[model samples]
Target: MRAMVVAAVVIALAAASPVLAETVACHLTYGGETQVIESAPLASPYAGTPTAIGSFFLFRIIFVREPADLARINLYVYAHAEFGEAPTPVQHASYPYPVSNHGRYGFTGLQRVYEPKHESELQYWCEMRGA
Candidate 1:
């Protein structure tokens, strides 16, 4: 049936595409420095929620440039992990002077054990400019 064929095609296309999460505007700050990076809608997936690793939370971040931009730019990404009412810095990572203007870049911070026996939170930010 025509309806069946259309459904099959839709399923095939969905399977071929990569799963993407919402893109959020973030302010990255580190060592008395701060910057904001605007990401394109439908851009490649960069970061995800921290995963539980035993008694610790593993933080991660991925950065990808928009395909429309041909200019090479350096991107600096920072991730902060915290627990309890007061956030305590647990990890810091960055990608400096990327060779390519396009593609995926990633960083994984050192695992930090959960404190106060509760789930931790993650904050992300980045700065980008011409190399």
Candidate 2:
């Protein structure tokens, strides 16, 4: 009976623990382009300044691939506004476990929360990093 209990406890523990899988290719679409970012380190085409969008800026769009039967992806979106001075982060949001049925996802129309007083340019970028 004791042996059986021990075996049951071991089985339970094993089931409770999550299994880590190898990193896979994940794609992020921003600024009319799609780039591949691995699960190892964050990677993106927009490494430097953020891209421009009218008077607002797109900070970044990062996608982290998850270990699931389907193409489950975690999407991270960030945006900021600049008014001649240093840029300030306006928005930061995350969508967890977004299933990518077509192996692709796109996000747009990120409205800037802060409005600049004078004529300013909006900058943005995208990146992919480890989950």
Candidate 3:
């Protein structure tokens, strides 16, 4: 029947792309407020973008699950825009894929990133989930 054929095609597609189920989550804290950002595996890192956090920080996470050798997660922390200017990157971190045991990786406790112009500090750390 047509229904059976459609089900078969769906199963075939799922089997061919198991990596679609993977995801990464990053936790960010600044100005006494905490936020979590989650990212799914991407086809291209360049497709990712940073998120605004509070009034002083911007955060971005890139998770890629293809090309086995290049599978990884990348984190970027930046100073949020001031006076309509672009956000400024303040820190970056990278982690390899297959993060075992839902592993927690990032700063020991909390780390600091300083905004270049005013030397203001931002705190952050991240963990991988559903990896």
Score every model by TM-score.
Answer: 0.27, 0.31, 0.70
RMSD (CA, Å), candidate 3 to true, equals: 5.5
Write down the RMSD of all candidates, one decimal each.
13.0, 11.1, 5.5
Model 2: what TM-score? 0.31
The lDDT values for all models are 0.39, 0.41, 0.73
Q: Which of candidates 2 and 3 reaches a greater lDDT? A: 3
By summed lDDT, which 10 consecutive residues of candidate 3 come out lowest? 100-109
| Top candidate, metric TM-score | 3
Clash pairs detected, candidate 3: none
Model 1 stretches astray by more than 4 angstroms:
1-47, 67-88, 97-131
Off by over 4 Å in 3: 1-20, 101-109
- Candidate 2: segments with Cα more than 4 A from true spot: 1-49, 66-84, 99-131
Candidate 1: 10-residue stretch with minimal lDDT: 103-112
* Candidate 3 structure quality by residue, lDDT tens digits, 58-109: 8888888788999888888888777989777788877787565333444223
Model 2 is weakest, by summed lDDT over 10 consecutive residues, at: 103-112
Q: Per-residue lDDT for 1-131 in model 1, tens only?
A: 99999999999999998766433234433333434444433335443443332233333344444564532222322233354543333554444323322322222222223333454333333333222
